[model samples]
Target: MAQISNISKQLQLKCSGERFYELFKNKMDSITQMFPKKLLSYKIVEGNGFAHGSVVHWKYELRGTLEAKQKLHMDDTNKAITLEFIEGDLFKDFEMVAVKGEVSDGGSNGISSVKWSVEFVKANEGVAPPHNYLQFALESTKGIEAYLCNNN
Candidate 1:
């Protein structure tokens, strides 16, 4: 049986939680524009947008120009979003990988935070879990926070 693992990270930002939630929940495609250095492009491969079951294709540079497809689910009331990897290099080592983000106030004026969690089933016990992916999410959140702060 595949081994399941989970990891989570929280990031505090000097931006509004509602704005961050809106961007993450609705303007995901625009993220490439905000972080062109890290993200090459993104498009909704299926569905109308950030709706449930929507497939999003992301092309980006990490070690190299890599692409991944994710199935998206969002809960507006809870300010949460989840993306399940449907296809990608990650799948080689993970039978399933779902990344979830929850946004909340950061206990200060104009400050917000996001909790990023990853749940994954390793393809085999021999395969090590991908922790770098969590770093990527944190870094991306920082970039987005900076972009929003500067642009606003």
Candidate 2:
């Protein structure tokens, strides 16, 4: 098994915590919906969409024709949202996958920051981090951040 690897990034947004949270929630949903066929989409399979154990199912597109089921574990507490990739193509073939979000107090700056992180476990025991995985995460983050910033 590969060692657990972590990636973290923080971004400041010019919005209140409540406003920021609302936008962030919507943006997350929007991002999750960007799967192949739109058939494998995410819904509140349990409690409210913003609560723990709120399961989200989506399809991760592999190449052009391959796709696999991805089940997400949600934890919304302490102004943070945690998404654990409990079941997915990436997790099955690879090792582990998780994404987390936390909102920082704006303080006197009037700008709130969102701290995002992703942890990955490798498929092969000795290989380095894959370029494609990093690219995909970066692209996805940029896409959602751009959309949220532009629209909000």
Tens-place lDDT per residue, model 2, 68-89, is 3333343345466666766655
Give per-residue CA lDDT, model 1, range 3-96, as digits (tens): 5689998988788888888887777777767778778878888999867789989887877787899999898888999988899877777899
Clashing pairs in 2: none
TM per prediction:
0.88, 0.63
lDDT of 2: 0.57
Predict model 1's lDDT versus the native: 0.84
Q: Enumerate clash totals for all models, in the order shown.
A: 0, 0
lDDT of 1 at 55: 96
> Which candidate ranks first by TM-score, i.e. highest?
1
